[model samples]
Target: MKAMSKWNKSVALLTALILVLGVFAAGCGGNEESDAIKIGVNYELSGNVATYGTSCKNGIMLAFEEINKNDGVLGKQIEGVVQDNKSQNREARNVAEKLVSEGVVAVIGPATTGNVQAEEPVLTKAKIPLLATAATAPEVTYDEKTKKVRDYVFRVCIIDPDQSQVMANYIFDELKLKTGSILVDKGNDYSVGLGKTFKEYFTAKGGKIVAEEGFVDTDTAFKPQLTSISSKKPDFIYIPAYYNQVGLIIKQARELGVNLPIMGADGWDSPKLVDLATADSLNKCYFTNHYSVEDPAERIQNFVKAYQEKYDSTPDAFAALGYDAGYLMAEAIKQAGSPDPEKIQQAIADIKGFEGVTGKLSYDEKHNPIKEVSIIEMANGKQKLIKKMLPEH
Candidate 1:
């Protein structure tokens, strides 16, 4: 009887061991079947534009979560590895090289055009396709005069000429500003591109550029530029740079007794703009953006809800652009049916009207997206929706 009882105990122990091993094998199978694809993201996560960078990172991560939850793209789980560009061009190059070294199939980011330009050669050499979410400089995908395509580089945002023309038309036809002064950031592709395009279209519409003064992005005090602009006594001041400098310039201009309306491009979409430039200083300010929350698009509403749930705040244009770019690349990859960079690039080149949170995107021959641009006006420290400019395609 003692031997029989001992045998029964041994049998039970064997059964338990087999059950544990079976469970372990099952878990391994689950993970193995869910193999992931790595997509790299480079952004200005910690610098002067940290707010925008953080927002973009959040959006991209949120999209990855959703995609993974849905079994990811093309039977593969989506993994995103993000790097901060530190809002510097050289850092952008480093980040791009690191991402390429990591075996990422395609990359999205380094938001500004300057950063994009700095990383372009590396990405081009690596043969990795880069889809910039918010780099609107005309040189993003081509040399404007030559109309030559920069094959490895593409943009999910509208290019500068489209945005610049829209803003010019809005000011001239909508606001009826026949004369204005351009306070541009010297040698900034973003500023120079927008300024040149606006000047051309504004002048073509019989408008006059009364005063033009160049300021560097790092310049803290703009009182002198404001004083110089004040001498021209133009109807408005157009600043084409990021909000960090734009806000300060506007505040200093106001403090220096320059009470003209301030206008800008999409770079002015930061909530910090309102926070930094106080109500009294930022009165009569307007700028262009990718989308307006108040515009009532279901995609925008969904994205905002998801973002609020995750991060407890609304998403800005940069965030929306990042999300769209990530999803767009995933879609292109699935369409290509392989991780080959050439195939993915070809697929992206043929991307059609994809309804994104930012806007409806369909690339033109120049690799520029044709979409609607939002004109937002700041009144009482809030972004008041003014108008939507549709693409003239």
Candidate 2:
């Protein structure tokens, strides 16, 4: 009887041990599954700015592929959760919320300033770092009223003030233009902000703004505004709007015999612009951009080659900015050595002299990238690099 009782006790002990081991193995498997780090991408994938968002998404995916090929950041594979905001403000905010709810470590883009602004409050409250790819409004990172940089917002592109001023200086000094007319999209924060800065700097540099006109994003008739500005006889017409409206404005202006050279900001970097306006209509037009494929630098050349090989198309400024933002986020995560948002944010702020496809980028106190601006001209229906403008202080 004693032997049987002892045998029963031994079997019971062995069964308990097996159960414990099974639980431990299951826990290990769960941890391994959790090792896949998720990053969120919010862009206007199917709306008015679909072209810009598609290019950005392509660049971001390429960067992720390269990172995964090299074992990823912090020994974990990156899984991107992409959401289409439809180029609507409310949709952008909703997408941001959904990404946060899904446990993303960081958010990458919304592409436009308005969308970025729409989603900023949500991200700020949640303490998630937002790395904007192409949103360049000055107020995106800096708050004038508070006189402080927003702690959680950062951008990979030059702000409107810098980009607008670059074009302003180029028109004033390089092109030797004295007077200009402004055509602004009143509904767009990007256009209005760029227009305001260009006017401020252009006039400060002894250039005259002979006429100013405004149009809504829905307005198809720019002929009346062009007629008024053309009568002013300014040396150039500054259209600080997106390519969609700017293309129409340029075509209509040409039809009205307004032949002065037209200048714009980075919003003009799209192939659709050529389709909307004739190649002849875009002649002598220039815009400030982030990168030019014509650049002879080895880094630029390699990126262009790889992009062309992968996408079978040349990358534009939006693609360069998206690539830069993706790599920047990965570098920050690697430096942090963890998926903690606060740690990643600090790591991003500390980055300096990081070589990017666009340029060597360093974050300023305002979390804005310190980089050069590329001025591109539409020559023979192709974008040609005209000059590189370095930041002044």
Candidate 3:
């Protein structure tokens, strides 16, 4: 009886030992699964450009959520750490540094050109891939002679030179505005880039720029500048800046009896434009943008439906570009078969003929996309689609 009891006790001890080892191995494996690949997001969440930044951030998050739902990149879950720059240059640089320190394989944004310019060099030094979703300044990816990008910088949107030429053609040929005044936002890189290009091509198209003026982004009263522009008796006014200042400029321009056709760049795609400008004041205003919500593409319609269901409103160009940027990154990672920064960068450079909700996307050698643009007009306090142009190149 004693021998049998001792044998039973030994068997019980062995069973307990096996159970402990099994649990230990399982715990380690579960932890490994939980620690997944990381991506970083930097944007202007708390300043003047907060609206565009937040919209882009939401689009990226939505895309990442969808990608993770279908198993994830390289069989591992993906995670994102988002940072806000508050639209300050110093904060933009700090945000980029923080994202790099978090060990993300890639970082997206600082959506505006000013913020991207501030952050690009820091990201380049870290050797992490940085994709700017809406920075359209020509200088973002080029030098004068070579037009080559710095090692770590890239942009997913069309550059200012392309947009400027498109706007110039639309205004001179389509609208037939021969003489105009230029009012630019002096503080923004986007504004400066677009303003310079428009001036160059408008003159080339035989349109005279009668008066040129500038305002800081934070300025609310354009009465003084508008007064001068109106005195010039121009046929139109070109405000190459975001909607916030554009609205104020329009409202003030009309109050001072400077009612001419107003034209602008993609920065004007916001509900705030209509909110600030009156029905009569906005009738002749127009701007160029990425994609139109009115477009009949199935992919665009599906994205619109999803966005409406989520945000309870229509999605703008900022959101569309953000969604496209996320899709591009994911596609490149998939094509590269790994998240190695060098491989992914090369694969992104080689991306051609990618169909996105925005439009058919192809990257240029300088890391800008070759895509079509839409011209939008405001009527009755709503956006009306005017025309779409395929890039002539």
Candidate 4:
């Protein structure tokens, strides 16, 4: 055998280097497979809707703690990568992009529909699944432009149509209210969606919309709108907005002698609503929520007790939704038998009926949660569960 030339030696050295690098990469991939599963938590930790985000974040944390304590899912711990989006649409998109870059298999999205929508494109392009905490607008799961379901997006909360129809039905058929007014934040997608659906369902049932007013989210005064609505003598008024604005609107409406029963969707679930609207002003005010602490179900009762014990406060609907999302994600991972995002998505889509603190959650074709709407009445600075309405579907 003859000795190899310098050029051949250089080629052999290069080939050996490539083989070594390949082995190193393969080892790293194997190590990662055995490590903790990464789940991203993108929330509005500080912004206009901080209350919702904070409550939801707490619930997610608690669920993870319980899961980790039990040795996590699929024999690997869950590593929740939490980030604050400041409740801004652009920031939400940025956070999602960051989570994707970090190699998260799935993400818990912001509590509001607009924020969730902002994050959807980023996650979808990355092929990562997102479980939205409370984004209930129908478009969150079903993309209007595509005329198809958003494959990467899922929400654990009842959609606007479901909650709005529940409230509309409660007022028209159950409460026997024939006419009502609507006040909505024109800029907020959530408010607009709920308002539109409530009107559609109420009118279809032979109920009349006596008045409708659109307000900007920054507006402080609702008396002008309330006065116009009061003059119409509507049996009830629907205000689809956040807790702060809804609270002030209720307080001002009551002060203006608009004694009509004021109803809203889940946006009215914050504890600060009592402080903002005043307990007396909340009389006859009701809202459709995800869950109520007053529920008698064993799961709800257990969650309420655990939440109060852990956080020293009762868990709201947002919290319940977040907690359910965490467990749901774990269940998906367990069912998938792998941390692959596509498998996780399929596992979640395959969920038939999942029982949680909120209710039995199944997904509609739109990937929207199929759960009962809890009508909560606000009275004397406390929330009371008035009724639970099952969806027609």
Candidate 5:
């Protein structure tokens, strides 16, 4: 009886030991964490700027799909935890908090400067890196007043000054358009800042700003400003605003018989630009962009082909930058040799010559991509790559 009782106790002990070991194994695995690395994709997915967000999301999805189909980073798949900012500041902050809660290693996008800035406090406090895909404002990665780089912030696009100054260089030195007019949106920092930079650079290069007109973002009627600009007879008009208003402005300017080359920044890269302005009206329109589908380089062409095959549309500068953001994160993860966020952040800061569809770039001290700008000219609804120029400085 005593021997039989001892055997029963031993069996119960063995069973309990196995159950505890199984629980430990499951805890260590933790489902998705063991199988994939998570990166947050917070962007303006469904809002006034839906075009930019959708394009960016499409590009990010393509990059991760390609990475996973082959060999994923560190033998684990990358999962993008996408959240829409809805083109609102409050929504952006909410998305940032949600991404942090999801335990993402890094976050990408909030494409515009204001939305990007809105999430800064949340992400910075959470110790998660925020990489803006298309936020071109100078303050996105650094504080203007403090004049210091934000430790947890980075970007894959050039800031406003770079694109603005580069376009100014092309206008004054290359295109030889010695006089320019500025039509700026008073409410938008991006538009207003671009005008300031372009004016500064162009005037410094011996060009004159013959007329400057201001309009609020909501104004659809731009004839008054257009008329004022036309009266000055400037060589070109720079409408430093987004596609929504810029499109109407272009159409109105054309109808008003203001026939001159109109220029803008990356905000003009949306497909809807042609639709809003009409193809014919955009003939002499140009904008400084991150990438042009018209680029003939093998790398650029290959990306364009793949994107077209997948999305059934031409990839814009936003898409290119988002695609680069995905690969940039992957590269940093690989270089860090660990999924630890701190190591990954350091690796990203040290990156140089990182190949992107837009341009081969390295992170500058300020974490902006050091890359050339592609000047895109619109002709009858078709985009043509006129020239690629490096920043003057």
Candidate 6:
């Protein structure tokens, strides 16, 4: 009886030990999954700029798929935690905080300048590297007031000042247009910044700003502003606003008999713009963009082909920039050989000559991409490449 009791006790102890070990192993497995290298995507997926956010998300996912197929970076599978910011600044800040708390090593986007700016402080405070895909504002990465680049911030797209100068130079030198008028959305940081830069560059190049007018984003009736600007009879009208407002402004301007050539910034590069404005109204319009689908370069063609095959749609500038941003982050992670945020930040700063779908990108001291801007023209509701301008810097 004593021997039998001892045997039973031993059996019970062994079973309990085995159960404890099993529970521990399961916990470790869960930890591994929780510790996977994660990249956060904070984007405006369901708001005013939903198209841009969706395109960027699709491109980033495509890149993530490819990276995982190759065993991901640093032997850990990369995962993305995507959150919609709803195109609101307050929501963007909250999204940023939520992503950091969830242990993301890096963040990819909040496609618009305003959203990016809104989330900048949160990510910077957390020391997480943010690679802006489509936010072109110079201040996205640089502080003009402090004359310093935010260490944790970087962008894959050219800044607004560079884009504005490119457009201004094209109008002043290539088209030889002397007098121009500006229509700006005062409520939008992107519109206001680009409009100011274009005005500065254009006037410095001996071009005259015959008239300047401003409107809020909610104001759909641009006819009054267009009529006022039309009375100036400028050679071209520069509308530095998003496609949502720019499309209406263009259509209304054409309706008001202000048929002069319309020029805009990268904000106008959306398929929805075509839906908003007629082809005849958009005929003589041009805008500065990151990549032109009409580019015949082998790299560009390959990217476009792969994107089309995967997404079953044409990739726009935002998509290309998002892809580039993903690849850039992967490269930084690989170079760092660890998912540590500081190491990834250093690796990104040291990146040079990184070939991206948009262009060959390298970050300058200010964390802005050193890339060329493509001038795209609207021809029969399609964006056609007209010229590529390299920054003088």
lDDT of each: 0.85, 0.89, 0.83, 0.88, 0.88, 0.90
| Best candidate (score: TM-score) | 5
- TM-score to true structure, per model: 0.81, 0.84, 0.81, 0.85, 0.86, 0.84
Candidate 4 clashes between residue pairs 3 or more apart in a chain or in different chains: none
What is the TM-score (0 to 1) of candidate 1?
A: 0.81
* lDDT tens digits by residue: candidate 3, 1-393: 999999999999999999899679746754775567677889889988898898888878777877889887788676766789998889999988977875778888979888898998887898888889988776777755675677667777887888888888898998888898888998877788788889988999899999999999779988999888888899888898878788888888888877788999887887778888767788888888888888777898999888888888788888888888787888878888888877877788888998887778887767778888888888877777788776555
Worst 10 contiguous positions by lDDT, candidate 1: 26-35
lDDT of 4 by residue, 197-310 (tens): 999999999999989999998899878888888888889999879898998998898888778788998778777899999999999989998899888888888888888999
Per-residue error for 104 in candidate 5, Å, reads 2.0
RMSD list, candidates in order: 10.6, 11.3, 11.3, 9.9, 10.5, 9.7
Off by over 4 Å in 3: 1-35, 74-76, 86-98, 143-148, 186-189, 215-233, 255-258, 391-393
Winner of 2 and 5 under TM-score: 5
Evaluated at residue 222, the lDDT of candidate 5 is: 90
Q: Cα lDDT for residue 393, model 2? A: 41
Worst 10 residues of 4 by lDDT: 25-34
Query: 17-85 in candidate 6: lDDT tens per residue?
Result: 999997797567548787579899999899888988999999898888889999898888888878999
Instruction: Return the lDDT, model 2, position 340.
Output: 95
| TM-score sort, best first | 5, 4, 6, 2, 3, 1
Instruction: Give candidate 1's error at residue 39 in angstroms.
Output: 1.7
- List clashing residue pairs in candidate 2: none
